[model samples]
Target: MRDTLDNLYTLDTLATFTPGVFYQFLMTKTQQFRFVKLGERFSSICGLPVAALLHDASLLFNCMTAEQRDELICDILHSSQHLTEFYGCIALTKPDGKQIWLEARSSPEAMPDGDIVWTGFVYDVTAREQALAQLAKSSELSRTILDNMLDSVVSINEQGIVIYANQTALSLFGYQAEELVGKNVSCLMGAHHASQHDQYLQHYANTKEQRIIGSNRVVQAKHKDNSLIPVELRICELDNAHGRSYLGVMRDLSHKLMQQQAIDQLTLQDALTALPNRTALNRRINQCIDNLALNPTQYCLICLDADDFKLINEGYGFEHGDEFLRQCARVLSDFGLYFLARTGEDEFAVLLETSEGRPSLEQQLGLIVQALAKPQQVFGDLISCNFTAGAFCFSTADFTYSDVVRSAELALHYAKSGGKGRIAFYDHRLDQHQRQHALLDQYLRTPDILSQFYLVYQPQYDVAGHLLGFEALMRWRHQEQAIAPDVFIPLAERNGAIFMLGKWLLQQACQFIRQAQKIPALAHCRVSLNISARQFASAHFTDEVLTEIRRSGITHSLLHLELTERLLLENPKDVVAKMQLLNRCGITFSLDDFGTGYSSLAYLKQLPLHELKIDKSFVRDLPVNSSDRSIVSAILLMAGGLDLEVIAEGVETELHRQSLQQLGCRRFQGYLYGQPMRAEHWLQH
Candidate 1:
């Protein structure tokens, strides 16, 4: 590090030069590097923008008990004396919870802004510590040093025969000291190197030049059990009065090698599901592409995602969300002889070998849906994981793996938007929506986007044509062009603008309800608002909602919080607790889009729910589709048993409403009553 520092600039210039250039130096050695200024608030560090930087407590530890960790934290964050400077080795716990040795130094300077700039250099000393610990076994020092070593040691005569064998060597090679006394030293190394040792020694004797005689290297060694073990060998050549001898030390690096391999795996494998991650998956696809030139095999890439999976993570907690991923991974891995990869939080890809005689892509998709469509039990909660698959069948026409993969991804969006558990196929003809993602991302960040956003209320009616209320739906218009919720919502969520948008939505909904109370026709009516899983998963979501409700002064029992069944499964106790807390405030809760998600009998009885809204997909073909009618009938019967009111959405025709009425559905929402309109238009109507 001093060498790198001197090569770059002098000590006097350190203040002027940015540390980002020096970061390349640290990356060559270790990845454990960070620097902070006092009053790190409202500032960026280490090339990280303010929005992307992790909090100090999160990067370090907030609840650490280790003395070294505590000491370091105190030195940097809460030092008593002005925290002038500190230079030493300390134990650093990485964000991944890995405890590693670190050699670090920090110099803090008090700035005019009442801030202290603490510039520091960090390096992981774990490998150095391990290497130092191995030096005793890796040197040709005194006998005391040899005896203290954990590795094996042996001495060989001019004839390449063993003259001395330490106890460690005897124990390691499964040979008795007496038996190995006159044996050839080549027995230790495997046959590959053993066969050439004598010739190499003779050549060295003739040439008087050394290749490996004084070097440290790793080689395959034969153990007494006839098993091959990786061992680090260091050799010292000695030429005494009579002839030449070699002092060789061997350290067992099997454990260290295994650790290195495990570390290597993290680059390409998912830590949560133990499946191949995006990098590995993309590599596999590239390999398949390369092989296609010769093999010409027919294959298809299916990119599938769990519908509304974000809600689980948001509603229950990240821990529960991880468990849900594990279950999904387990199910996907169960499929026969397919390359499965987790590409995103809820998205997965399967490279299936779909030749002529094999099962068709649709058949395979059906099997996957059938297997994963069942309710999963996570932390004693019944959660559903239904797959929406987008498939792209490839042939000789596809030149690159990205081409097919991108097409598959495009198809996946269609599948998700088409309906729950549906499949969308993307061929060469369909235009990819990938280009719009960046544009949408940029547009969402524009000022006055909130003003361009609006709410359209779709009215809900009872059996006697009495107005019950309306469901508030969000819409966005960009330059007079109406953008679908499916497009902009994902962009906002990804870029972290959703938090602001979510608060805005809640405020508007509450204010609408609060003001609607003054109108005689809408005074006693219920107004429903949709809540995003991401918004609800926040740490202070319930408090945020309650605060907005209070600020809006909506004290009447006119507000209803609508959520999907999958959302109800995440942190059920917490959800129920929050529901019960708000229920006391006259706010009602309803399970929205029912019959499309995983709903269990156990969770239903525990929720303080007022109604169940059957999804439009079930009610779309109610009069003609018997299958849809049967599903509606089953849902109505289940709601009837639980004493919950059932509302049918998308009742366009008179026959659709009549069918739902006969099925005992009391409330309706569709074009038959009224299409969604602006608040003023609907109010005037």
Candidate 2:
């Protein structure tokens, strides 16, 4: 008995220290339930006393809800009936509001006394359950993040079969989630790449070489509709417990590519005429030059300019002019030219293959000329579409694209000069003219260009040969060779060197007239300096002229500014204003080269003036040409009526003087009286 008592005490002490509660439950055949042995830890888990549970084993289930209590009873009854093991899990909240999960399992036995017994253990399983719940929540959060991304995400297994696809991936490839899950990833690739995918994977597996991993590339992806879509794909290799897999992130490049194509189209096309622009023409010429090596065919570059296109702008409006140009473009397009482009305002270029061996180049050129010269109705007016063209033919690739275009443009320039509405072909003389122009342009760019040039004075006299002042003529001597005024003057104006040249001329002429005060023959004489259209149009022209006159300390009345009829073609209001301002300051103005340009009595009456010079053309034939005599007579009569003085240029004989003298001409300037000479020689004369 003492040994039995000691054994029970030892078992009780072991049960008290164990991590779980040890218990014995019994169910009699009469449906009565009781706990024969209960551990003290039971009270700690269920918040009840072991003594109470011992009295009525039902108290052990009091902490559970009604549903849980019923389930526990059913489990116990089934175990008792079948003499099988019983297992159950239930959640309960103690009186102190501490919640816990308990798990119990027991083996059941049927006793000979018609009662069922269970020996079981109950454990607190709250920590393990909470950890499992947290893991599931974390997985759901990761899934949400992947599904909501902007870029498509896809994961494939080692066999290249898709194992996972995000919402973006499904939408990007136009596939449902289930439809793409187990399919080979190559199904979404083009045939070329699809056939090579497995090889890529096998190569990577064998050699561990990264051919495309961790890199971005643009590729074509097959859509569900069997159409190709451009996409930027990036891939990475992943290593996890599930073995090797690949992750691909793709971005759709369709919209971006379309926008780039649009921008490129705008770059090569003209907006107004809807034709290829200069850049496109240059590219076409380069292509022709490149192809010449293989085919050795002759090609011609024709540059065309619409003659008097500006008349449309001035007569109607710029809108009507634009319509006119568009019509011209349509007309040119109808000719089936090889390549056509709009090179500038009212300028078009064509590239033609001359080796077709048909109706010769001249015949083709004539056809084009006739077609363009036909009048077209524009905004209710029959406007002529007359165009002048210049062409250059070549069979070799010896010239650059710009060189060819420049040659054609040079021909066009000569054509326009010869007479508008004609076609001109390139020649060696045109090439020489271009070279000379280039050399003169280089000289004009020099800083000391003013030093290379000097001025000579041509004496102006009355009919009796009494001297009036002198006209300053600019002369340039380079390498002891004289360059004509018509050659370098236009070049200087084009290159913007005229500004510097004009200022220098004003200073030199002012200083000379100031120095001429010592000579009795020229003490009160006025020196006339011709002004270019560009110089006269300067915003600071008045200021520059006044500043030079003030610096020279010469009377403004002793300075005479000669202006060509071209000067009046610009903003006449500004011209009249400037002329009136200078005239108010005692500076005289004269219309040089009268009756040669588009000037009328309206410009003459509006502009503040003091004199008119008959151009040498109307005076060179003097007493012989009836038309020249009539024009000169009319000019003298008009100048007299306007209270203006007249100077006749290019007089070389007494007959010239006598004719002018009879026609009421007082001023005569030519070799007949005195020729252009150096200032020192003129002072001596």
Alpha-carbon lDDT, every model: 0.72, 0.82
Task: List the candidate 2 regions with Cα displacement exceeding 4 Å.
Answer: 1-274, 307-322, 355-363, 379-385, 417-422, 428-432, 539-556
Candidate 2: 10-residue stretch with minimal lDDT: 132-141
lDDT of 2 by residue, 1-685 (tens): 3433443345455555544566668889898999977777778777878898899776657777899889988988987664556777678777677778876766564443577766656767665344324433442224565676556778788899998888878998999999999999999999999999999999999999987997778899999888998987878777655677887877666754543344334435677787987767877887888888788899999999989888889988998888888988998899998999988889999889878543488688878888888888987888886889998887898877768988888889989988888888888799898899899999999988888999899888886767789899999998799999999889989999989989888998998888897788788889999998998899999999999999989999999999998888877888999999999999999999999988989768877889999998888787889999899999999998899999988888888889888999999889987788888887774
Predicted model with the maximum TM-score: 2
Model 1: per-residue lDDT, tens digit, 1-685? 2333342243223323322111111110122323332222212222223333332323343323478665765665542133334444555544456655545544443322334443444444454344334443543335554555466778898789998877777888899988888989888879889999998789888997888976777899998677998897878776555566887878676654543343235335666687877656666776777778788777788888888888888888887988888888898888874699887788788988768432467887888877877888999998886789888877674556657777888888777777888988885445636566678898888777798899988899999999999898899988889999978887887887788888888887777777778888887777888877777777788889788877788764778889878777877877788788778877888899998888898889888888899999998888999999999999999988898998998989999999999988899999999999888885553
Q: In angstroms, what RMSD does candidate 2 have relative to the true structure?
A: 31.4
Task: Please identify model 1 stretches exceeding 4 Å from their true place.
Answer: 1-426, 429-431, 445-447, 490-495
TM-score of candidate 1 versus the correct structure, residues matched by position: 0.48
C-alpha lDDT (0 to 100) for residue 582 of candidate 2: 97
